[model samples]
Each structure stands twice: as C-alpha cells, then as structure tokens.
Target chain A: MRVRAQMSMLFHLDKCIGCHTCSVACKNLWTDRRGAEYMWWNNVETRPGTGYPTGWEDQDHYEGGWKPDGDGITLRLQGKGKALARLFFNPALPQLEDYYEPFTHRYEDLFDAPAGDVQPTAVPISMVTGEPMNVDGGPNWDDDLGGSDIFARNDVALDGVDQTIRAQMEEIERVVFNYLPRICNHCLNPACVAACPSGAIYKRGEDGVVLVDENQCRAWRMCVAACPYKKVYYNWSTGKSEKCILCFPRMETGQAPACAHSCVGRIRYMGVLLYDADRIPEAAAVSDAELVDAQLDMILDPNDPVVIAAAHEAGIGDDWLDAARRSPLWKFVKEWGLALPLHPEFRTLAMMFYIPPLSPLVASVERELYRLELPPERQDFELFDRLDKARLPIRYLANLFSVGDEQVIERVLRRMLAVRVYKRRQSVEGVVDDATKDLLASVDMTPEEAEAIYALTTLPTVDERFVLPPYHREMSIETLNDPLAHKGEVGVGYLEPPRRGW
Target chain B: MSDTVAMIVFVAFPYAALTLAIVVTVLRWKLAPFTVSSISSQLLESRKLFWGSIPFHWGIVLILLGHLATLFFPATVAWWNGVPIRLYALEITGLALALWAAAGLLVLLYRRLTTARIRAVTTPMDLVVLIVLAVQIASGIWMAVGYRFGSFWSVGVVVPYVWSLLKLSPRPELLQPFPFILQLHVVSFFVLVAIFPFTRLVHLITLPLPYLARPWQRVVRMRHIEPVG
Candidate 1:
C-alpha cells in the first residue's frame, strides 16, 4: 500500500446556524486583496439554492470535474489538444458576471453631505473600475432562501427527486433548507491540478492540501472552470487564479484553519486521515451506486497493525499516526458512517465530509393553527424509519451526498435518531429502556458505540475535535537555511533569479 | 554614402537586432518572470478577440514557415517552383493569407481602441508593438503586389545574402537590386525581432509544448515532483 496522510475536515451540518462567521474569518485572512474582493475562499451556501455562482452544479454547462470514461476517467473539459488551441480564449471560463462584480459603498458621501432635509445614501461603486454601478448581485444573494423563486427553483440536484416531492418542496408550509459552508475540497483526484496548462497547481504530498504556486501560474484560467465546486477564483489584478489554501501556514504552526476555528456553531472538525494513495484511482473509477463505499474503503484504519507498519515505512511519524487514531473525521466518516462527501458523482473523491442536516418533521396543519408541539417531558416513542415523511425529501439529500442512494441517507438518519433516543433515555428517565436498546440494535449500533457518538457529537472540546499533527517546520527550515546565519545579513537576497517551471 | 547606409541597414542592423533580442530576452525572463506572458485581452472583450486572434495566428504561422523555407531550404523551394503552376499556387496562397492577417489585425486594433476595459489595460509598449507589426505587414503586402514573382528571384539573391550573414561575411550588395518596399519588409522583420522580449510576443517562445507529452495529474513531494501516474 502506498500510504499517505491527508488532513481532512467534517462539518456537523445539523449544528450550523448559517451565521456566515466562518466565511468572514477566511476572507479577512486570505482573500482580502484588491483583485480578490469577489472571492470567498470560504462561503456558507443555502441548500436547495443555486449556490454562489448560479447553477454551478450544472457541470454540463460549466464543464467542471471528471466523468467515468469506460474504465478510468477523463476530464469533462476538453483534452490536451483542444485545451492548447483554446488557450487564447477559454470559452468555458465563467465571466465576471457569472460571479457577481464585487462592489463597495462610497460611504464617504454619508459624512461629507451638506446640511439637508434628507439623510444621504451611500452609492455602490464597482471594485474593479472604481466606477459607480448598480449593485445587481452578490456572493450570497440566495442565503436563507431570500430569492427562492429564482435561485432555489433552479437547483440542479432537484432534477433527481420525484416530481411529487419536488412540487411539495416549494410549498411555503412544506419548505425546508439547510446551510452548506464550502471551501476547497482539497480532492485526491483534483481536476484543477489536471486542467492547468502551466502545471502551476499541485496536491501537496505532505498533507494533501491542493495549492496554486503563484509564481508559476500563467493566467491560463482553466482551473477556474475545471473545479466542480467552482472554488477557484481568477485574480484580475495579478492575472492569476487563486483558491483556498486551507490556512496551511496556520496549520503548520499546529492551529486549525480560520474557517474551522471561527465556526460559531462548533460545526467544524479537523483531523488527519491515513489513506492508501495507490487506491485513489480505483476508488474514483467505481460505479455511482458504489462510490460512497469505495471512497470510505480507501481510508485505512489507523490502529490496524498492518496499516500502521505500512504508514511508518511510508514516512508517517508516530505523532501523525497517533493523531490519525484520535481523528474525529475518522469517527464521523468511517467508523459511524454518518458523514458523506458532497456530490461523490463528481468523482473527485472530495475529502470534506458532511453530516446531512436532519430537518424538522413534516407538519400536519389543520386550518393553519391547530397543531401544537408538546413539551419535552411528554412521553414520545415515534419510529425514525419514516424517512419519507421528513420535511425535505430523502432523495434530495441522497443526490447531494450519495449518487441517488436513498438507502445510505436513511441509515445515517436512523442511527442519529437512535443515538439521541439512547442519550435522552439515560438523562431524563434515569434508566435505559428496552425500546431504546432495540432501536439502537435495529440501526446495527451497540449502546457503548451510541454513547461514544453522542459524547463526541454533543460535547467535543476544540482540542479533542481538532487533532493536528506537528508539521516540524523548524526541521525543514533549518535544512533549507540557518535562521541565525540571516541575523548578520540585512534582508532576504536571491541566489538565483526565479524561472517558470513545473 | 549609399554603400555605408546599406551596410548599416543590412549588415550592422541585423546583428544588432539579433544580439539585443537574445541578451534582453534572457535578462527580462530572469529579472521578471511574471512579466513574460501573452497578456491576452480576450477576457475583456472575447467576441472581437475570437473574431480576430484565430485568423491572425493561423495566417502568421503559415507565413513564417514560408519565410523560414526560403531562408534555410532555398534550393528545395526553387526546385518546387520550377513549374509555373506550382509557383502561381504558392504566390496566390501567400497573398490571400497576408490579406486575411491584415483584416484580423485591423479588427484587433479597432477592438483595443474602442473597448473601455481593453483600453484601460493598454500600455505604450503594446501600441508600439502593434505599429511595428503593421509596418511589417503593410510592406510585405506592398512588395507582394508591386514586385510580382519576387519569390522566384529572392531565392537566388536573399538566400546567399542570409547565408553570408550567418557565415560572418557581410554582403550588402545583393539586396541593392530590390525595391524600397522589399528592403522595408526586411528591415521591419528585424525590428519585430528586436522588440520580441519587451512585448507580449515573448509568449511565442513560452508555448506549453511540454503539456502535449506530460501526464495530466501532478503531485509534488519534499520539493521534488513525483513522477505523474
């Protein structure tokens, strides 16, 4: 096995409140430059909405990500010959209009206004040209389903659901939505790396953080189109493409990423996963029905004696291995099988897993105000097997996470309900009920395993959730140069002029 | 006085252009690698670019190959032109491509002048390169029409003259019989080469030819790139 370590993340989406704190934190750190005003390296999206770049999931139009081509896979974007020919003008590239033209208010007018009867209003100006412009759209225009008619109705994933459920989804009384905060997936089979003509983008062998080497980028802009998530953004000022770096500089110093660290709802968890690098291709080449299981299979068990020895030989230190064993991502994604990747059909093998949000149960309203939800003390023992009766169709969640595998979504939801039942029975009744035990067994989970899931999900501290391995930056720095040697010298000096290369 | 002027234009100027092109291109690439680019204006106004760039590139590529053939393989091209039909075919094809290129360049120039976004990004150097290119094209078109069948005769005179330059033996007398337009074409060609590194034309040498043979996926490890699988 060609073992490699990957630092991954899991979002307990149920806990997310759609506050957009993580997005602001990431923007303040990385993409606050002049050209990057429109880029949100981390942005919270409302599910059932058409996302930031409208209809980005319509890969047929944008031509992003990979497709199953007979045995292996091929880029959905054209091959090499066509790519080189189109280098002069990439027809597939999203226009500045596809992503909204970033703007700022001319707030100076508010204070500079002469004494008048009316209060002065700030006029929005285009950030690109510094000219006055009408504000047409923004990064999160569809947040909280504000424009559900235009954006939510056009959601590409809705095509997978039955017509009846799809119709029911739009009804005001039956509407359902959730928050989906996104950053670069740092995919194992990254399409951005594959599409770059300059070979500027690469997946780091150290921790699998996909990075764009700014010095090597030739402004080809192919990566901007090829990423299925549309996470890569073109910087108009420097004439280069940029994306989320996962805050590698912070991570190397043993800290969580800005987005994860600043999550207000405590929904984000970060950790390392040891995976067999050799199996990446095989895992991605599987059929759509088997993709979720295939991806899960590639993540090697950290405590396995054989895997541990293989990782050791493959240059994984004991510290990283220990972190991998305690990885919350492992417990959430592999052990409990609760989280699944968003849209595995893209075949990028995206590493960011998400626990599908469990929405409120469908309401039975008679005459618009008859039903009342009882207090928590009332004895209730309803079966969670009625997945079909949830406010949101299971098919929609299936389409988002698995490739139309409703069974997978049902299993995860039932297990979560079972865990909650087991916890509540212990806390409120002060005794374990037989019904709760049967419910746990029905989901194929023992009480001890359920208790572990409950503890981690409900009451995990920051340190426990984010198990970071030491990057040993000091060792690498010393090998490259002596810090003390630079003390006698004035500033940095280049021994050789920089040249463009792979 | 005429001999001295011809020597400067034909002998001294060619060498100067060549030396400047090489030394300055290397320095520019070393000192500012980021400046080396096509500096494409397609993103600002793509419709005009598509209408202009494709035809211009194709026309220029074939015309360049024709020039190179006359320089290096004069005997072969001369032998092929022995038949009147073959000579006429080649001459007509060259004239059509020149016209096509000129039309595309006009469109491109109009777009750059008119488009607000493109004009914002335009530099004085960009304008100079365009004017230089226009001079070269206009001279060639003029020579092709005014001095008909010059290709059949240039093989005997220009080939030997170019060879003499490469051999370090200057020969300014051979181009004396040529018209002023023909001389203008030669001088303009050298001027284009002289400004190669300073302009967006640096992209000509930076073609991603390596991409054709290289693997799609890339993974880097420990400052050393792993062999693409």
Candidate 2:
C-alpha cells in the first residue's frame, strides 16, 4: 500500500447550538452558482426526523454501509442493484417531483399595495394551500435550539429516573428527544469510498477529511446514493458530483472548520490525528462493529516516541500533533468509560464524540423543591416555559445527559450555563468571555461557577490500554469470512500499519 | 435538413466529440495525471467510465451510418448496386443494434446515478446530457418505425442541410418543414453542441486512444494543498 494520508473530524455535540450560520456560510462560499442551488456542503440536520432528502437515516432505504451478521458484513444495495436499475437504466433517483415539488410565486400573485396602504397587510398565501406559506422541512426543521427526536433515541444514559423528577411531570407529558448537530464523520470505513465503482472517493491521512476529484469524475453520481449522510451532491452545470471539501483551505492556514470555528456553543475541536497508514485497508475491510476498535487503535499518543518519530517522518508539524491530543476520542476511548460511538452498528468508524451531559442543576432543583415540601410546578415556571419554548437546550441536554425526561427546561439551562472554560490553542479561555458574561449571568451562573465544571471534565478520563472486544482488533488474514463478498473480493486494502508507540 | 444530411452531422458530431475528448483525456493523463485527486480514486474510475462510454458512443455512430444509407441511396440504384435485400436487412439489423446500444448506455448512466464513486463525480449537467440522449434515441426510434408527421418531404431538406454543413454552409431551410420528432431532435442537438465544449462530455472527443495516452499509472504532484484547521 502506498503511503497516502487520510483526514478525519471529531465533533462534540454537547457544545453545538443549531444556528444556521455554518450552513449559510458554506452555501455562500461553495454552492452559490446556478444549478448548484440545491447543493449544501455543510448542513445541520434534526435527528429523529427524516433529514433533508427525507428518510436519510433509514439504512434499509439508502443501503450505504455494511451491516454485520455472524460471520461477516452484508452490503445492502436497495438504492443501487439490478432491481432498481430496471426502472431507469440511467435512472434518475426520484427528483423534486418524486418528492414534494417546491413552488415559487409570480409578482402578479401579490396585491399591489400603495406606498401608504397600512391596513396591516398580510403576507401572500401559497398557491397550493391558499393559506400563509410557511417553511416546513429542510435540513434542520427541528433545529430551533431545542432537543430533536434523534437525541432521544440514542441517549441510553438516562435510565431509572427518581420519583422527584417524575413528580415534576405530573401535569405534562414529558417526552424526551435528542438533537445531533451533524457534519461529515469522516468514517474509517466510508461507504462512499467502498461504493465507488471508479474508486474516486478517498479519506485523507493527515486529518481524515474525505474529498472528490472533479477532472476525473465521469458524472456517474454513485456517491450520491452510497453516502448515508447524503453530504455528496451533483452539480448539473459542471456535470460532476461535489461535496464538503472539509474546508481544507481554512484548515491548512491553522483555522478551525467554518462550522466548528463559528460554533456558538463551542462544542467542536479540530486536530491532525496520526494513525498507522498500514491499518487503513484492514480497517476498511472488516465488519463495521469490528472496525471501530481498529480505528481507536490508530489514535496517536503524543508522548509515544514511535508515534512522535512517525509524525516527524510523515512531515506533520508539532502544532498539529499537540492538537490531536485534545480530541474527545482521545478522552472517550483512551480516558473516559462512558463515551461511545453514535451508532456503532453503521461501522463507518465515525470519529465525532459526545460527552453525555449530566445536568446537576436539574437534579439539584428538583431535589430542593421536594425537600422543602413545595409543589414542583411552582418554582420559576415562567422561566421554564421560556426555555421550553426554545426547546433545543432541554431536548439536546436530555438526550446527551438525561434521557427520556419530558420536563427539560430548568435542567437544560443549568447544564448549558455550567460550561466555564472555553479552550483555544491549548490555553484556557474563560467561559465568561467579556462578550458573553451577560448572557451567562442570566442563566443564573457566575463566571466562577462555569469554570469549575470545565476543570472537572477536561482531563483524560478513559484508560489508553482498555481492552475492546476482539472485533475492534485487526481481523486475522485466515478469517477471511465474508459470506456476502463477491467470490474472490479481498477485504479493504490499507497501505500503512498503525504507529506503534507507548 | 434532408434526413441524409441530418444523419451525417449527427454522426460527425460524435466523431468531433470523440476526437476532442480523446485528446483531453490523453493530455490530462500524461501532463496532469495528478490533477485527478485521490479523493474519489478517480484514476481507476475514469478508466471504467471511459470504456463504458466508448461502446455506447461507437454504437451510436454505427447506427447513424445505417440510417444515412436508407435516407440517401436511391431504391433503384440500390438494386443495381447489388444485394438490395441484404443491404436493407443490414440496415434494419443496425437499427436494432443502435437501440440495444442506447439501452447499454442507459445501464452505464444508471450506475453513475446510483453508485457513490460515479455519483460524486456526476454533475447535474451530466444527468441532463444523459436525459437528452435518452430522449433523442427514443424519438429517433419512434421516427424510424413508421411514426410520422405531415410530410416525409421535409426530411429531404435535412439531407441538403447535412450536405451544406459538410460544405461549411449550414442551410436552415432544409430543416424548416421537418417533423416534430426531427425538429425536436435537431434543436436539442444544437443545444447539446453549444454546451459540449464546456462539459465533461468534452472527454468523449478527447480520449479516443484510451489508456495508450492516459498516464493513470504515474504519481504526479496533486493540485490541492492540505487544508489547515
């Protein structure tokens, strides 16, 4: 295997506020051309919802990644194979008409109001509905700063709730949901990489970012169907497919990704992760579940001489090496025990990590009211309503920290305001920066209070030598046990071996 | 334009596109081999796509040649020219092969639409080009099998038009009375031409020698610098 570099990203969902700034910034930069209107290199999705194209998360429909059974993994191709092929030999997946078509209105449809016509003019109505037209669904229908349903399903931490919490929910149906501020996970076993008949998609070695070549593209559009993330898009005018470049241009200059750089919640981290170049092929070849451990092993230990030597040999700078140490995976797999992959079953070796939120405020508030023998609903219900109306803080925090609780307002605010130190360049920046202390104070936390929470969680929490299931290690060559592989197809091919260092 | 002339230009455009596409593919292979990034492994994919596209295109050329013979050769002259029945049979068989070729092209297109590698490389214009080709082939087949308009005489104009193009004097009058199917085909054909040079379709004319001139095996300097974070 040749020594080509791979790039990857690790997103911290606990810190993302679902503002569309990143989406707008990306759209303004890359996809603003005519015919590129529908393309968005960076988009925010509301979890538990259908996502942008609708039903994007349903693997059965898209057939993106490999699903493991007993012996091996099966490649599902419901979106590709012969069954669907007969429909359009050069089939166009159902276009806008196949879904709900978007409509725009002509100037004639609106009434011509005079300059001083002030009778409280109402907005023009939709032609289809004859009622006020409202934006229904897109990439982020549920991203209104609240917990989306996706968070609710995946957060398994919240179990066996206390009676005091249940008592607070007596009058309301306290259903819990989650919101995942998703971006390209830059998988170890990228389905788009595997599905390319032309083998055009690749994961970079330096940062693990995935990218596409325009000149070599034959305009096949296969990656569109192969990516479960649906991040890849086709450019009609150019006759080629496009996707997030991972803002490599910005990264090279030592700036964060646009989404990460602009994150209001400060939940993102970017760094150069050094892995064994040799293990990539093996990692790509294994089942998705087994693939996770092979990937975790690739995380470079900064203090390891061999890893340090390999980084020097590979031409990576020390700044990047230092940044790699700060990654959440370095904490979850190497430091903390609680952190886990979002959907280990997908087997893409997704790099993003979430340190499940633990709402001390919510727990404290509920406990104090019960001790005083006061009704749970009477304590600052107005504040609760306002926070609940926004929805995201409650929904996302519940999913990350406390799952299945319907009453999320007070708990969510207390947790959000709990963050104190915002780390930048390995040096700590006070969470109550001059710009945000006012907003921080309103949540009832002093700058000192937020800093304390940051100090507790910043250190490594997971042990580096922690043993994972055998599936996480490199599969034995003799165990070439894929039942679904096309006859002689060997496993994924990797050129470089993992960097071995203490 | 007379059907004969229309057929010639239809056949020639492929030759032009094929020639230019071959040259571009070859030059890029040798000079800018690394210009095609490892992002999607396009070096390997470009080869497969090139081969699939070749058969589909060459098939169209052969099919169009047969169409020209039917339109231009006089029936009496064909008999005196010997083996009229055999020649007519060959023409019919060629038309069938053309339809089959179109279907094969559709298969290739479907692969692009559904596969991740090809799909990522695909532009909306690429799909539009495929859709246009599909429509053209469908309509041409309809016209060949007794689907008609007000007059067959208009087709004679297309023949003259083809001759004029070969002579560098495109005669629009020959195409004025052409049937709807033929007119629709002609108008779409021009639109495809105007956009051909600007698209990946340009590869069709640039890579006729395939890998002989393609430098897919070489490692070259990549164009994209690593993005800093």
Candidate 3:
C-alpha cells in the first residue's frame, strides 16, 4: 500500500446559512488585486441558481474535466497531440464577460459634481478599462434569488429531474434553496495538472494542497478549461494562472484557511486523510455511476490497524495520524457516509465533500391558507420520511453529487433527518417515538449514531471543526534549503511584487 | 571587410553565440525557472491560430530534424547523395519543407499582425524574431533554388566548416566563397542562436521530455528517501 496523506475538507451543507463572510475574508486575504478583482476564491453560491461564471456546470459548453476514453480516462479538452497542435490557441477558454467585468464605483464623480436637484451618485467603472460603465453582472449575481426563473431555473443540476419535480420547484410559494460554498477541491486526480503543458501546476506532497508555481505558469489557461469546478483564474495583468493555494502559509502555522476561519455558518471542516496513492487512476477510471463509491473506497480508514501500519511505513508522523483519527471529515464522509463529492462524474476525484442539503418540505397552498400535508400513509411515520416530499428533488441533488444515483442522496438526506429527529426528541418534552426508532432502523442507523452526528454537525467547537495536522516546515525546508538560514523569515512571499510579462 | 572582422564574424561569433546560449539558458533555469515556458496565447484567439500554428510547427520540426541530420551525419548524407535518384529526392524534400515553412510563417505573421489580442501581447522582439526566421528560411530556399546540387555541395562545404569550428580551427575560407544569401543565412542562424536564451525560444529546450514517461499525477515529498513500502 503506497499510502499518502491528503488534507481534505468537508462542508456540512445542512448547517450553512448563506452568509458571504467566508467569501469576503478569502478575497481580502488573497484575490483582491489588479487582475483578480473578479475572483472570489471562496464564493458562497446559492443552489438552484446559475453559479458564478454562469452555467459553469454546463460541461457541454465548457468541456472541462475528464471522460472515459476506451479503458482509461482522458481530459475532456484535448489529448497530447491536439494539445501540441492547439498550443497556440485554446478555443474553450472563458472570456471576461463569462465571469463579470470587475468594477469599482467612481467615487470622484460624486465628490466633484455640482449641486443640482438630482443627487450625484457614484457611477460604476470597469476595472479593466477604467471607464464609466453600467454594472451588468457580478461574482455572486444570483445570490439569494433562488426563486427567480432567470437564475434558478437555469441551474444545470436540475436537468436530470422529472418535469413534475421541475414544475414543483418552480412553484412561487414552494420555492426553497440552499447555499453551496465552493473553493478549489485540490483534487486527487486534478485534470489541471494533466492538461498543463508547462507542468507548472502540481499537488504538494507534504500536504495535498494544489498550487500553481506562478513563475512557471505560462498562462496556457488549459488548467482553466480542464478544471470542471472552474476554480482556476488567470491574471490578465500578471500573465499567469492563479488558484486557491488552500492557505498553506496559514496552514503551516496551524491556523485554518481564511475561508474556514471566518465562515459565519461554521460549515467547513478541515483535516488530514490518508489514501493509497497508486489507486488514484483506478478510482478515477471507474464508471460514472460507481465514481463516488470508488473515490470513497480509495480513502483509507485512519483508525484501521492495517492502514496505521502502512501509514507508519510510508513515513507519516504520529501527530498527523492523530489528526486524521479526529477528523470530522472522516465521520461525515467515510464512517457515516453522509457526505458526497460534487460532480464525481467529472472524474477528478475532488477532495472536498458536501453533505447534501435537506430542504424543508414544500407546503401545499389551498385558497391562500398554506399547510404542509403529511400523506395519509406517512401520518404514522416519522419526520425523516418527509425527505421524499422536499422542495428540492433528490434527483437534482443526486445529479449534482452522485452522477444521478438518487439512492446515495436519499440515504444522506435520511441520515440527516434521523439526526434532526433524534436531536428534537432529546431537547423536547416527549419520549422518542416508535416511528422515529423504526425510521432509524430502516436506514441502518442507531440513536447513538444520530446523537454523535448531531453533536459534530450542530454543537462542534472550533477545535472539533478544524483538526489541523502539524506542518513540519523545518523538516520540509531542510530538504531544499537551509532551515536555520531562513529561521526568522516568513515562508510564503516574494521580496518584490510580481509584475507583467517575463 | 578585413580579416579581423571576417574572423570575428565566422569563428569568434559562432563560439560567442554558443557560449551565450548555454550559459544564459543555465542561469535562467536556475534563477527564473518559471519563465522558461512557451507562453502560449491560445486562450486569447484560437480559430486563426489553429490554421497558422499546426503547419508552422510541423514544417519547422521536419526542417530542423533534417538540418541536424545533415550537419551531424555528413558521411550518411554523402552516401545517400551518391545515387542520382536519392540526391534528387533529398533536394526536392528539402525545398518542399523550406517552402512549407515559408508559407506557414506568412500565415503566422498575418495572424500576429491582424489579431488584436495577439498584437497586444506581441513584443518588438517577437516581431523581430518572426521576421528574422522568415528571412532565414527565404534565404535558405533561395540558396536551394539558385545553387543546384546544394544537398551534395553543402555536405563538402558547410559540414566541414561547421566541423572545423567544433574542432576549434578557424576555416572561414570554406564559407567565404559561398553566395551572399547563403552566407547571410548562416550568419542569421547564429544570430538566432545568440538571442535564443533571452527570448521565448528558450521554451524549445524545456520541451517537457519527462512528461511522456511521467505519471499523470506527480507526488513529490520533501524527503529524498523512498518510503519503506
């Protein structure tokens, strides 16, 4: 077993409250620069809405990620021969309009204007052109407009849902939505790495954080096309591609990434996960339906004795293993099987997993008196059975997460329901209902499991949410340079500011 | 016009170009490893580039490979040229490749000039390089056309002159008698070599040779030692 440790993240979707605090923190820390103004490295996208860069999940248009070719998977963009041939021009790249033109208010107009009946307002100016312009779009243009037909109706994830379900979702009174906060997944099988002709982008070995060596990036933008998540951004000013570095500088100092640290909903969980390095291709090569399970199978159990021995043999330290054992991601993803990777059919084997959101059941409208109807057969059933009646169809969640496997989404939603019911019973005055007990039993869950899930999801402290492994910077630095020589310096910065061109 | 100038141009200049190419390329690799890439503008304009790039790269690659073979393996070239049919075939193939390269370069030059996005990124050096390359190829085609039996003649004349330089013996006399265009082609070739390390031409050296054999995903650890698995 060629075991390797990958730093993984789990975002508990049920707990997310749709605040853009994480987005602001990430922007202020990283991408608030000349060419990167439009980039939100941690944008909170409202689900059932067209995402930033609009319709990024429309693979037919973007042609990002990997697809099975014969026996193995190849990049959806181009193969080696085609890559060399089209080395001069990539047709699939997104334009500035696709992602909105970054703009700032022209405050000088407000200050310099003469007094008149109409008040002088700050006009929006294009950051690129430095000219007065109307604000046509933004990074989060669809934020909280979940019921809008223009934004939410165009969501590609709903393509697989039945016409009835889609119609139901469009009902004005029954409109429901959830937040989907995204960052670079730092994938195990990153298509960006494979598509980079320059060999500039790479996944770090010490931790699995993927980074673009900006100096090496020739701005091919193949990484942009190859990434199904559309996380990679190109800096027009610097002439290089950039991406989420996963806050490695902060991580090395044992701090959570800015997005995770500043998250208002406390939905993000960070931790170490050990996996067999040799099985990456094997996992990615599986059929689309089997992709989620195959990827999960590749993540070795941290507490397994066999895995522990292999990890030790692979030179993983005790502290890292301990961190892995305490990982909330381990509980959510592997042990409980509650979380699923987004667009596993992309076949990049993304490291970030999300627990499918459980949108509340749509209330029936009757002569202006809205009421939730528990079906006659399910009247005796527990609240968990109401998952089938949720406003957001399980098929839509399945299409987003499980490559159209509704069973996986159903199981996760059921587990989430079980935990909520179990928690409600404990907090309220009533004893646990027999129907609730039967519901838990049907899903192969116990009261203890539900309680444990509740504690981690609802009541987790900061320490429990982010279990950071010790970053042995000294050991890593000694391999490439003298650690003592640079003892007092910060590890991650350029002495001079980066400029355009070579 | 004088012996000193001729010696510098023919002998001293070749050595200087070779040295500059090697030393500066090494320095750049050490100091600015990241900038050593082709800096492809593919994302900006693709349709016109698709037509302009493919033939240009293919034609140039064939021409370069043929040139390398003739330079390094004079005896093999001579043996092949001994037959009239083989000699005629080699001459035709070289001329065809040169013409193909010239055509491709013209398309590329047109695209570079006309495309707004490409023109924006086009530095003066980039234009100079393109013009110089076109001139070099045109001069080469001129020599091939004007001087019949150049495939056999160059084996005796240019090969020995190049070999003499590698052997550290100045033999400007061998090239001195050649036509001005042929001489200009040789001089411009060395000029390209001299400016190569400083330009995007440096990407030719960093062709990602290891990529073919490398695993799809690279797993680099801080430690050099292998795991005990």
State the local distance difference test value for candidate 1: 0.84
Give the CAPRI rating of model 3: acceptable
TM-score of chain B of each: 0.94, 0.57, 0.93
Q: Which tens-of-lDDT digit does each residue in A161-197 have in candidate 2? A: 3334433422233332334555666666666655543
Instruction: Please name the candidate that would achieve the greatest TM-score relative to the true structure.
Output: 1
Question: Can you give the TM-score per candidate against the true fold?
Answer: 0.92, 0.54, 0.87
Model 1 has a DockQ score of: 0.34
Where is the poorest 10-residue window by lDDT in model 3 chain A? A377-386
- lDDT (10s digit) by residue, model 1, range B27-119: 877767766766555545678887777777778778889989899889889998999999999999998998888888888888878876667
Candidate order by DockQ, highest to lowest?
A: 1, 3, 2
Worst 10 residues of 1 chain A by lDDT: A374-383
Runs in model 2 lying further than 4 Å from the true structure: A1-8, A68-75, A78-136, A144-172, A284-291, A313-319, A326-329, A337-339, A358-453, A456-502, B1-229
Decoy 2 TM-score against native: 0.54
User: What lDDT does candidate 2 reach at residue B227?
Assistant: 22
The deviation in Å at residue A397 for candidate 1 is: 1.3
Order of candidate numbers by TM-score, starting with the best: 1, 3, 2
Please provide, for model 2 over B112-199, each residue's C-alpha lDDT reduced to its tens digit, 9 standing for 90 to 100: 7765445644667667777777877776667656543212332356556666666666565565565678777665665566555444
